[model samples]
Target: MIGEELEVLYEVDSTNEFLKRNYRSFHDGAVVVAIKQTAGKGRFGRTWYSPEGGLWYSVLFKPKVHIGLHVYTKIFSVSIAEVLKKLKVKVTIKWPNDIYYEGKKLAGILAEAISENNRVVAIVVGVGINVNNNIPDELKDIGISLSQILKKKVKITYLLDEINKYAWHLLVTYRNEPENITKLWKKYLYPKEGAQIKFKHEGEVLEGTILKISDEAMYIDVGGKVHVVQSIHELVE
Candidate 1:
């Protein structure tokens, strides 16, 4: 934890891109924190309106394990949830990479990895949280920030500290039991139990019961049917 390094930037296209470009040169646990992201994005090329006064950061990790790429995304979501919990903010994670409060999205994550010889060389987990900022008109319906939910401005620096502390704790814990992180992830996932959710996968739209997390994805049982999703980029009404 104490050995970790941070590279702060005033503005960047994307922290994930910055670290990925220099992955070979840096050691593990190096992080990039950006004040503003000009070309931020989520899964499936979706635009991420980072603006300012939000947490726009990514962690560079060189794990010793060869687990599938999706597991890291779960780790990130769980890490974020833990961090928020410590800050006294009630937070939960939606499957894949969304953090939720009262069923509205409070944060989102994007995980990118580079592999060589069928093994991951490095992984960049980019996280964006709506904190200490005004929600845009278009995002008001779909998103909520700490300030909006609490009816006051929340300190972004305090949130960043929480995130940094929990991330380091998760990193050490992950080395022992990767699935343990996933277990915590399942606990805070939205749609708690028996909640109906619309989902899209494999170019087809469907509805499903979130049966469980299996093999780095959600094992959704839809209409007595089962499907696996590697990413939850699109959730329909």
Candidate 2:
């Protein structure tokens, strides 16, 4: 029941922002999709290059039980990767929430939460996929489209149906067996042990080696000290 209402728009500034502004009116399990986004957003205020042929959408979920923000992000990443596998595409998830294929970015997930009186209310999950779009020259080295990978156009409707199916399944699992979701996420993680990486945190750049990953943070070994990073802006490897 994750996508009970699908709202289709020809254009929008940002699907996540749109849902946040009007979430009070929409019921739970509502979805907002845009054909083109002029100002699509990414993690840490980055702009997502969403053109006409890509899939840009957001889903509103009202969980019965309280779920941490990091856990919610992992749910969507795992669901998206599951759908892509059904379409005969192999994908790996970068830490915290990015979908990568063959070392290039294929999709991104952004989760925003709404709270009232110190209690959680609703969560908006935004997803962007390079379905049939053309990657720009500047992004060609880092971005890729499904059509480009498959050498043919992929039907948007079919992709949406598959995504909705996996989304609902994951949501139910999260409400019932949350630990299993975390196991699935770890199974799809891209990096190996002791890999060197760099990330931006709190307006400062730090380099570290991966030590371990918990539910909501990554433990890294930096300068002979273990640093726990709850969120990262960029992954420089």
Candidate 3:
């Protein structure tokens, strides 16, 4: 039911922005898909290279619980990863947001909360997938897509609908189930437990292993010292 009203546009500055700007006019499961995003962005305001042929879209949700934005992100990440896995893509999540395959980024999921009268009215979750777009030469080492992985063009419409169906189920389950969301994300977590992870820490690259995860932060063991990280930018590979 997540894509009750799927609206496709040829272009947009940002699907997330467009949805937030018109959330009041659309239903809870309304989605906006863009063929090209001129000014798309990822975590930390990094400019996303969303050229034509890529899958860029945002979904509007009004869940029953006022959970943290981070929880929504984790839920959506799993949704996207599971869908990709069904395509034999073998994608994994880089900590809290990015979807990676074989150490390269396959997709990125971002979420932002919409507020009204000091209360959240809706949350917009956006995903950008490099389906058939050509990865820039400079970013080729860090970027990937379905077309590149499958060696064939992918049906954007089919993939989009599948992701939405899975995401809707996960989001609804999260709303009703009294369970830890982190447990679910860990299933497809990158650099699996005890694996050496080199991430940005205090202006220095440190090698560590993820020891634990909580709703607020992840505990990493670096040189016998445990560090708590709450930012995804620091943990992204």
Candidate 4:
């Protein structure tokens, strides 16, 4: 069972960091959550703003060797999106792992691998959802909370449980039926096929139309030339 053991903290530097540092001490399904994170982390060395009222947590999982680390981020993110939609939040996913509502970010995820001898042994997946937390006016254009969208405060415990339940169900489905998970996740991804997009490549920005998205890369038609966008950071939007 996922998240069968849990740890709740008042504050922490980073929920993901806590799990990684103590990776050996906890069981495979253990989870760690914090009310506030002073030094939250984001993708590509960016900082994750995790103030009070958001759900900041990490899950420890030791999966099969063939599993790609990136898949955890995608899987968990879609689970979050599913839960929000049930609340009538109308959430959508940004490829590679982010939840957005009307172009503003609602959540982000970070999944790291614990490796030994060049082989991944475990993964720590951290998730952050902007719930009832106050967003500064300057950052309001890029961030939003559940309360802001629903016009009411969402109970933190209830939301957390919903997310965990959906995630675990999807995980089990993935293990038993691996073929359809990707399509299910892609159903909510934004910038759908044929959308015009821009990105930085080799220090120069290029424009393109999204052709297709595979697990490892997004095939884009740039000036009639297909350029594979393998990293989410390559996207300019």
Candidate 5:
């Protein structure tokens, strides 16, 4: 029953922030959607380009597992990719959380956790997808929308329904067999074969080949040395 309790706003600062402030009152599977976001956020304090014509929403979850927030992000990424594929949109996920279509970013997912007294409380997963919006000049080269790809206006209601359906299915799979989530994520990873990948760790660029990926980290072969990347600031492929 994911997204059973949905709150749609005409405008908001950030859906994730909104959920965090009101998390104590919301139940599991509650969702907050904003038609337009003034201060939407992305990973690492980046601003998420959210406008009226995009799908900007966040979901609240009370997971049984306390740790491994990255796993939840992977689950959402896979769910969105699966839904878009069914709509005849070719999409691939970049390592971590960015969704790409024809090498341009289509969507981004951010996961935030709330804890008290060293105990887990709730998790908020925010997603921003460009549907019928016109790409701003700054993002014109790197951002793309569903309408742009399909050359026609897409129905936002149908897309939201599909996303919620797949999200619930993946959430169930995650609670049952978490390893399958990693497998599905890797299966849809962009540049699936050997390719040069670079990520910054500890203020240093670590370039390598992506050997394998798990829920927590990525194993990379860099200069004959295997480096475990737990957190990446920038990823280039």
Candidate 6:
């Protein structure tokens, strides 16, 4: 029931952009939901497909703590995981900010914040979840949606309702029990173990085995050398 004041739209380049440009004078917890985004973007400036039949929305916040951007991104991902789990969907965090289902990306998060004098002014957490769209050929190998996997039409309203409830819960809990967020994130990590993943960090390609996922990040064993990664962009495949 948090920010149920939905500003539903037909199309926009980015919901986050809309909030950033217009929410300066608005209250926290305002929400902007869009049907289609011409230029939806993922983490690290990658293009996101937000044609239609998906949930594209952003929630505005002025956090109590002015944490680093990286920490905020983790919070965003954790929030998404919380909501997806409530909807009876098997989801996991893919670090930095992606929600995965059955080894393919089901949702992605993009967080944009405005800070002045080292104080946070506004934060827009953008979430894009594939709900009812047919999987495009280009992304079939790397992406999967709830509707596609379940063979049933998913309603945007249902997804949005869960998002509203979970978002409010996370925001409230974040202030009193931030550790709970990290604990839930660790509970559902993609490729939890025994899976080989390719990563590109510091301009080098490395393959590694996923050993464990924890509160800080993922424990990946690469050639007997373990690396704990927190950013999703650092992973290539």
Please report the candidate that would top lDDT against the real structure: 4
Candidate 6 or 5, higher lDDT: 5
Q: In model 3, what is the error at residue 199, expressed in angstroms?
A: 3.5
lDDT winner between 1 and 4, please give it. 4
| TM-score of candidate 6 to 2 decimals | 0.82
TM-score to true structure, per model: 0.85, 0.89, 0.91, 0.93, 0.90, 0.82
Clashes of each: 0, 0, 0, 0, 0, 0
* Candidate 3 stretches greater than 4 Å from native: 178-180, 235-237
Residue lDDT tens for model 4, 86-130: 898898888878899998999998999888899877799999999
Q: Assess the local accuracy of residue 197 in candidate 5 as a C-alpha lDDT between 0 and 100.
A: 83
Task: Report clash pairs, candidate 1.
Answer: none
- Measured with C-alpha atoms, the lDDT of residue 233 in candidate 3 is 67
Model 6 spans with C-alpha error above 4 angstroms: 64-79, 192-237
Report every candidate's CA lDDT.
Answer: 0.76, 0.86, 0.85, 0.86, 0.85, 0.76
- From the highest TM-score down, the ranking of the candidates is 4, 3, 5, 2, 1, 6
| Model 2, span 77-186: residue lDDT tens | 99889988987899999887899999889999999898889978999989999999999999999899999989999999888778877878887766667788888988
lDDT of 6 by residue, 195-216 (tens): 8988886889889998976544
Instruction: Give the worst 10-residue stretch by lDDT in candidate 6.
Output: 66-75
RMSD of each: 2.8, 2.6, 2.0, 1.8, 2.3, 3.2
In candidate 6, which residue pairs get closer than 3 Å at backbone N, Cα or C atoms, i.e. clash?
none
How are the candidates ranked when ordered by lDDT, highest leading?
Answer: 4, 2, 5, 3, 1, 6
Off by over 4 Å in 4: 64-66, 202-205
For residue 113, model 6's alpha carbon misses the true position, in angstroms, by 1.3
Residue 177 deviation, candidate 4, in Å?
Answer: 3.9
Residue pairs clashing, model 5:
none
